[model samples]
Target: MNLKTYQAQTMAQALAAVRRELGKDAVILHTRTFRKGGFLGLGSKNVVEITATSGVNVLHPTEKRELLNPSSVRRNSHTQMERKISPMPPRSALEPSGPAGRDHSESISSTNRSVSSKDYLQQELKLVKQMVQELLQQNRKQQHPSVPEELFSAYMGLINQEVTRELANEVIEKVRSQLGPSQIMDDIKVRELVAETLTKMLPAAEPITLETTGKSKIIALVGPTGVGKTTTIAKLAANFKLRENKAVGLITIDTYRIAAVDQLRTYANIINVPLRVVLSPEELRQAIDSMPNMDLILIDTAGRSQNDDLKLHELKSFLHAAAPDEIHLVLSTTANQSVLLSTIKRFSSLNIDHIIFTKLDEAVGVGMLFGVMKKLNRAVSYITTGQNVPEDIEPGSVGRLARMIVHPQKGSEISDDNIPSIAAGEIL
Candidate 1:
């Protein structure tokens, strides 16, 4: 066997070296990464080391033919064995009439069938592997023609997270343009650049703010049904009242579901905050007017299906009457890009001031949020991770969101303390 070790600054380069030296038939034995060539480890550069080998006894043309056609090899062996024993039998004697002849014919038939089946499976498996490799190569070329090999993994990571192909391409192209060729070889530098590009793509996180001396900061949560708007409202109310020490009042127009009103009412009672349920726009105005002393007034509207024009119009009328300082369109991260975009488009007439993404823990990836924000051009206020009242909610941060999109595996597991605070104009 011919064994060799190859080293390069990046895995792509190392693999390229292995393929060039050992051919495609080489089997990888081991791989590792280490830092090398720096004084006292102060400026050491990371290097990828790989060990690979071509197996012993490279097959000759004849041997290769026998390996591919095992039936031919077996036939030749059987002919030689017959010649070494008694002379070859006559055709009539070989017929499956007698008991011994029948057993012999059956054994020969089974061996041939076994060999044929094994050959068919081997061919099929080989074709499938080739198809997969071709598809992967084509995908890389189609998705990222200009993307450097060193940065291809990051580009694919975004796509795997459900980021739009156009947006993912734009991000990779930006990273490639900003860094010099040598600098792009650094994995850490490429990651930071990818995060930075994604951060710039996101709208700034603008959570609701309260005025010191003015009418209460009326904020409304509106979205499609079952998106946890009521629970999110409770979370916001609890954070403001208990954490920020602000006088918060809750108003619900979700009379369609008695359970939703009762849920919010129960939360209000526990938090010692006033709760009001209003049916009509007139009563909604009366509810707001009735809470003049409150610092923040959170109005939870009934979830209106984006497809229902009548319900949307009714919800719009109530929002108009309240004249909220901010109308946050709550969206769930679990929805696909089309559903989210459609919801935003349908609700655009309501003048969505900002967005609040809920159900982060339940989502596979938050990459769709990037496409939604890019198209809507609205700022994000907050994100809800779970059903926890106050603990699951966090002020949306561009850094945290960018990180989530870049590293989806860790996105769902992020906690309050460890959440990065990279808002607009900030990076980590």
Candidate 2:
């Protein structure tokens, strides 16, 4: 391998110099920019530098010879196969004339080495081919050619918002396809179309209400640890019982953490609602039956680690006993996209009806939530912005969430301030 460095005023010039010296097959090792020819760190000129290498020897002599001479290689392979099947006669029995015998032994030894090298080369070649195929496939699926500057801004905005590249591309492509040339020329119109398309992609369910005419609704909050499940439940409890004037009861099976139980108990006391702490699945059943007259029973579960299958299954057993009407899989908006997906997959054993995203206020970017909602295909019911009870929670809306993800500067446009507040006397 030969390595060389080139410096020029611009990247194009530096790249050209590298290619001219190193050839088209050159591999770029590094690139950097620096200021030079300046006195006292003033009036410095910027220069682009590139380090490149070429003539890298990748193949062994034996492998190259075998690749170029297929007939001789195949003949040698056949001879090897026959030798393996039928062992060679003893040296004393098959000994040839002195010089010829030595030559035959050396030829056999060389052929053995060649065969071993061939096997190794075949494996390496297979791996290289697989890598090339994968790279080609990825290239095919990568984003299309650059769009006009106006459209490119929208595309990059989505990416900056943490939206998946594939999804962002799809959104841009959809907008491009639907709009006419005249419409496309207007950046505002194009951006609005993109936002509208993203908003429509998010599905939201009706808010859980205890005032319904149907049978008493039982809702369970489940999620991985530190996702704000207990706090979210407290918010929901306050909204339903204190704010909605409906009979609401609380049940918690999160005995694993003493703090968790105390937290829910504190919320129940503040909200003036009956609270039950059960130990086992049978106890959970009893807790459900004991709260028959309650308009709604909000169950708070322990925040189990998604990777702990045993604990998750145990949690599922409790859920099986209660058989709640709604299982709200609580997730934190600040969580990494991969962790959120793992949590969802782990908790999927129990039926999930709605998704509750908490800590939206703390999230740097909520665009990953778009991918999560789309991939899970579960409707979002509520999104909690802050720690304030009942104040920070809002009924999930497709338009609100989509707008937040696509254009985060616009605060959640869905209004909850005017939502009717319930009378305290009704809870007693």
TM-score of each model, paired residue for residue: 0.69, 0.63
Give one digit per residue, the lDDT tens place, for model 2 in 224-291: 88888889888878887766777889999999888888989999999999999999999999998998
RMSD of each: 19.1, 20.8
C-alpha positional error of residue 412 in candidate 1 after TM-score superposition, expressed in Å: 2.3
Regions of model 1 farther than 4 Å from truth: 1-135, 415-428
Candidate 2: minimum summed lDDT over ten consecutive residues — where?
Answer: 85-94
| CA lDDT, candidate 2, residue 399 | 59
lDDT of 2: 0.72
